[model samples]
Target: MSRTKSERYFFLDDADREAVQAKGRAHNRLGLVVHLTSLRYPGRFIPDPRQVPTEIVAYLAE
Candidate 1:
């Protein structure tokens, strides 16, 4: 994991934290690791397989 920090709130995979490392590699950014306790609507949380962030998505495609 990259040693960067910030105050922005974002979500990531709980199981594969490698995504976090990947995110860091993409932008070299990081912050307080606040774990989400619950999801208000699980449906809204589902990721769209067709659309993904450009940087990390490229890695997934490979």
Candidate 2:
């Protein structure tokens, strides 16, 4: 008979969970465009608006 591998799960402690929640709330207040981009590119946050292409910004505006 073959043995099945067990799965592991990890969880955040109360303090860590609270800290993450607070950070998420602050990020949400930055506006929809910011929130969307952050979700799309997890590594990048608050990229400079001036450096972004005008066409992209216009698209996001709509």
Index of the highest-lDDT prediction: 2
Using all chains and alpha carbons, the TM-scores for the candidates as numbered come to 0.20, 0.34
Best by TM-score: 2
Residue pairs with colliding backbones in model 1 are none
Per-residue lDDT tens digits for candidate 2, residues 1-62, read 11111001112346634545555454342344544454454445546646544544443443
User: After best superposition, candidate 1 residue 56: deviation in angstroms?
Assistant: 1.4
Candidate 1 Cα misplacement greater than 4 A, ranges: 1-44, 47-51
Off by over 4 Å in 2: 1-31, 38-43
Whole-model Cα lDDT per candidate?
A: 0.31, 0.41
Per-residue lDDT tens digits for candidate 1, residues 4-60, read 211112334554356445454433323211212112212233344333334333332
